[model samples]
Target: MSKKHRREEDDEHPDESWLLPYSDLMTLLLALFIVLYAASSVNISKLEELSHAFDNAFSSGINILDKNALIKATDEQNKHQQQRHEDVGARPNKEQLKQEEQENLENLKKKLDSYIKQNGLSTQLQTQLNQSQLLITIRDNALFPSGSADVKPDAQKLAVAIGQMLQSYPDYEVIVSGHTDNEPINTQEFASNWELSSKRAINFMKILLQNPAFDPKKFSAIGYGEYRPVDTNNTAEGRAKNRRVEVSILRKYTDTATDDTVLDAIAAQDQKDASTASP
Candidate 1:
């Protein structure tokens, strides 16, 4: 009678094994809720503690990655985005491009002036801005020996720097001109001032063109030997001033002149150097 009663009780109760998975599912849901609450509250210590506990309790085959890794990835992404934004902001637009030529010329002048001042090259180098162009005059001795067209080794850096600056506005026409005092010359390499000046201009231009960023089509070389004198040839100082190499960055649209002629724009400097040596 007892056995029959026990079997009837089992039939009415059904199998209880199905409750194991349901209870496990409830535990997993509870763990998820705990994790979400801890994470939302920024309680990293508590969240790590709960994660470890739940991992041990429900050790099937699951793992939560370290929060630091996720945080690091997010930080890197933000930095990259910021850098891209800065680059875009720094780039010139069409309106800025139209005005950049003038602004770039002015900024280049300032940079050159700073370099000249820092290096104490005031006597050997100077810059002039006129209606037609931007003129950079370098004394012959700065880039060459007494009568040689070869550029001085140390002065190559200056050429490279000027080239770099000019590359910023590559569309402008650049003229490298060589000048000489009234003194005559006769050598195996150069027969007269014309040849000497021409070689000097060509060599310097070659150095300037060494910069790959510079467009070769925008460059030209001229030899104004004993013709265009910024100072008189009567005195030693005047002669020294007359011998020079001129790098002129020509304006793209000039109604009048092609060269950087000393117009009234830079007349004050001429007046200042009057009866004196000028670059």
Candidate 2:
């Protein structure tokens, strides 16, 4: 009776071994579903947190989850890189800037020439464009009286017109330079040609600055006096040519070289003056 009862118990149990694998399969399926759900959101931070948790829980780190997170991060980085490239492509390059600036200066020169010709003031005013700058030269008699540093009332119109024209190029550096003949001057107002020339340059520059369109920081005034002469002061015609004012619109590309040349000329003149005075 005992033996028969034991056999019945064994038959009733009927190999509970299958339950172990079925439970394991259910657990694996649950984990896989959780991983798939996390991946669908594409939140790298959350994925990284989950990966770290899995790494702590298991001896071997969560290699599969880490790989998915890396892929997501790479995709995002690539998207940002592509956007940056497009943005850079939309902006003007250095060569384009140079070309545009050159065009602007050329157009400005043409307008000035047209105005000078139309007003029949070509004899008094002249414009020349070179590699380093666009120079506008005005005879001293056109803007001032004999031995006077003040600008004539009629010349104010010319100054105003020039100031208006310069409004288009606010970025350019403007230099107003005053020059004089080698004739010695000793007046009550001006002690010498140096003071006369300097005052003239400052006064003219102030007139241009009155337009409010010009940047004060970009504008400067200097006096060369009898030095840096374009013509010899031996003849009446040469002296007339030497006594003038120059408005220079310096080029951005050659500004450094232009400045160096001016400095060198001034130094050389100073040395010559010192040598002449020593004797």
TM-scores for the candidates: 0.58, 0.69
Candidate 1 at residue 248, lDDT?
94
TM-score winner: 2
Overall lDDT per candidate, in order of appearance: 0.81, 0.83
Model 1 residue 239 lDDT score: 90
Task: Name the Cα RMSD for model 2.
Answer: 9.9
The parts of candidate 2 lying over 4 Å away from their true place are: 1-65, 254-279
Residue 208 C-alpha lDDT in model 1: 93
lDDT tens readout by residue for model 2, 32-65: 6877786687666556655655665466644433
Candidate 2: which pairs clash?
none
User: Using lDDT as the measure, which candidate wins?
Assistant: 2
lDDT of 2 at 259: 75
User: lDDT (0-100) at residue 207 of candidate 1?
Assistant: 94
For every candidate in turn, the CA RMSD to the true structure comes to 14.7, 9.9
